[model samples]
Target: MFARSLPIISLLSIISLRSVSAVDYSETYVGCVSGTGTSGALASPNVNTISDCNYACADAGYTYAYFQYQSAGSYCSCKNVGPSASEITPAVSGNTNCGGAAAGVNALATDYYYNNCYNSPTAEDTTSQSTFDACFERCTTYTNAFVSPAGNVYSCVCSNTASTGTAQNCGVSGTYFAYAHTATSSPSIVERRKRRLSERLKREEQTRLNRFCPAGLEACVIPGLDDSFECIDTSSELESCGGCLYGSTGNSNASTGIDCSTLPGASFGGTTCSAGRCEISACKEGYNLVEGRCDWHV
Candidate 1:
């Protein structure tokens, strides 16, 4: 009885080992699912749903899988089961071959276009519809015909034979179309002109001020004169006025025989000399004459 039991146990152990060895660790196409895009190879062992294809492929030991449709439509799912952790790279296809090994190729192409090409306004408007139709038509034309510099990949071109004539008709309208173009152009030109005018006015004002003040010289308007006088010019009688004044100094300097250069200790007034000339004979308190010149006492 012991010898018979030993044979049975050994046979059962052999059968279990065979079953474990039979499991294929290779990548495979699981089933149909949804995805979008047009370039790059897809991984295997995938089933289609509006789910995360990246996670699915990674879970199945695949580097990546391609999705074919933006909506809920037929798609290909793949996974990589290559030994030694090698990635399964597939050939780029114009259409998704959903049933077999080509299942996720179309989805990959759609993703490539939308992410890379459709980001720009010119590319997006031109290729969005074309890309959609090309995916539908890829079941037949698997040729590597068109390549986008922006997308950095090859893709299928959809037939635009119908809409070409209509686009030409729209370009030929009337005066309204001309007016629209003019309207856009005029504002930019006007803004440039206004900026130039403002700059010119500022430059002219600076030039006039520089002529009279001539850098590094303090300038003062002469009392009772329309012109300004520079302190650098000793010949100008206005500079002899005790201190600088900003505007027309109304006859105050001429009426008082006070030589501005001789004012003992003068302070700036709002617009005229007030209490620094000793020739006035009488002055307000906190003032006194020193050597025939008015000076502040305190």
Candidate 2:
């Protein structure tokens, strides 16, 4: 009798372990992300359903759980930063298998999940931004910017003049890690990240037809504008990788791509846009790729 019971118990244990990612979960739904993930991934779990994977992610003490459609619902991992996920990472929006906001977007083994950085203080020109590198990329046309990151939300404000805001607590009433621009030419190491988001919203419509794009191109909405968009070639765009989008937007914009150029501080030719991400052979200078966005040094 003891022998028979021991085998039964062992079999049950094996079955339980195998079901960790076998179905969908009822946890609050987050948005879908595309492109590859930044490092810090644990060995992924194997399951067969979105519900089951969501449960597994909760068990792992993460706020979000993501899986790939090609995995047939088995390959998945846990994350704490989600819902307000990585808009900085491009996407393949309209994927029904991902099981999140709107019709649904999809994820790849390389897809990323990130925390939301919010803008509490609110600037005159703000956009959905996550990392300092992303903010820097957005402000490529401006001389200054303000980045505010709050829980589950992130944003960057672009400006043409250097700001006195500095790295202060202005976004969320002291609940922010806000960075402000200090100079027109360069910034102090600390200010580099704060004012990094100075100019990236400037548009060049000389070669664009807003209502529609020529073949081999897609229309992407421009941030800080009203019903405005740009035509781009996802295959080679630095700002719209993979597909095309400003952030983790819905299919309404027609695309959900990441800004592959957000790998700020990258040495000339250090980072390249491949499909939908900023791929690099190695990190040069004071740069680190965290959660799919470049860290613009301290």
Candidate 3:
């Protein structure tokens, strides 16, 4: 039985290898990042969607990006450093529906949570923030931000500057929450996603082409054929090549592929076709082709 299962096991192994990618981004979602140290913040109101925000952050040279909803639509904040363990609340996916005042935390605009300070002395501030989203946005402005609730007032404060340092137990007397921003994205994952997206687009294009062209012939256009498509064997056709383009002139007849041998300067020129394209390696020694015209080599 073990011998019979060898091939099955090997096939499964190959399938698993093919399926592996960077990581499951959905599983990695960490609520809403609120507090961060006092640095590495690039904020923009235009960015929407988590992927777009992550890409923008990566482009801005940040390793982590955070998305949050505010009064002004949605905003994305980029930062290099990640939140600390102490700052992160455990498994808080959305704003906790404060079952009355006992719960203390208010309902965010939508629902947001992150690795942040929860009624800790680490984030003590004088500026008053009315809502959690406001406090979150305020924290993003600085490298580190924390929210402390004194009675009904929520004060947003900065805990540290730079990527280094630790949170202090300062806001013990008041209900407070602190959060730090951490880099949740990496260049490798971005590249993988891009590659997958590109492959999907290519597959979609090919599927569309399949609907139009017969077997063996791919949907393509000949050189000089603008806005026109033809079914041609790119593997053997001398014109369409891997794509289409008669060369710099773009003056090839759409119905028939270019005949390099028929050209004046290319006469007696040893032209060969490879991979569905034609190429003239050399013009008969004394011949030259220049400026859309071919002539004898000077």
Worst 10 residues of 2 by lDDT: 1-10
TM-score of each: 0.16, 0.25, 0.32
Candidate 2 vs candidate 3: the lDDT winner is 3
Candidate 2 segments exceeding 4 Å error: 1-26, 35-38, 71-73, 83-298
RMSD of each: 31.0, 23.3, 15.1
Deviation in Å, model 2, residue 248 alpha carbon: 41
Candidate-wise lDDT, in order: 0.29, 0.42, 0.43
Per-residue accuracy of model 1 over 124-231 as CA lDDT, tens digit each: 112321332232233122211122211222232333211111111111111000000122333443344334434444544444554665554434445445654444
Better of 1 and 2 by TM-score: 2
TM-score ranking, high to low: 3, 2, 1
Predicted candidate 2 versus true structure: per-residue lDDT over 122-168, tens digit per residue: 45677876544456456655555555444444556766544433332
Model 3 per-residue lDDT tens digits across residues 74-186: 55666544443233332233343111111111111111233333444444344786654456555543445556554455566765543224433333434345455422322
Give the range where candidate 3 is weakest over 10 consecutive residues by summed lDDT: 1-10
Q: Report the number of backbone clashes for model 3.
A: 30
Model 1: CA > 4 A from native: 1-46, 68-75, 79-298
Clashes of each: 31, 35, 30
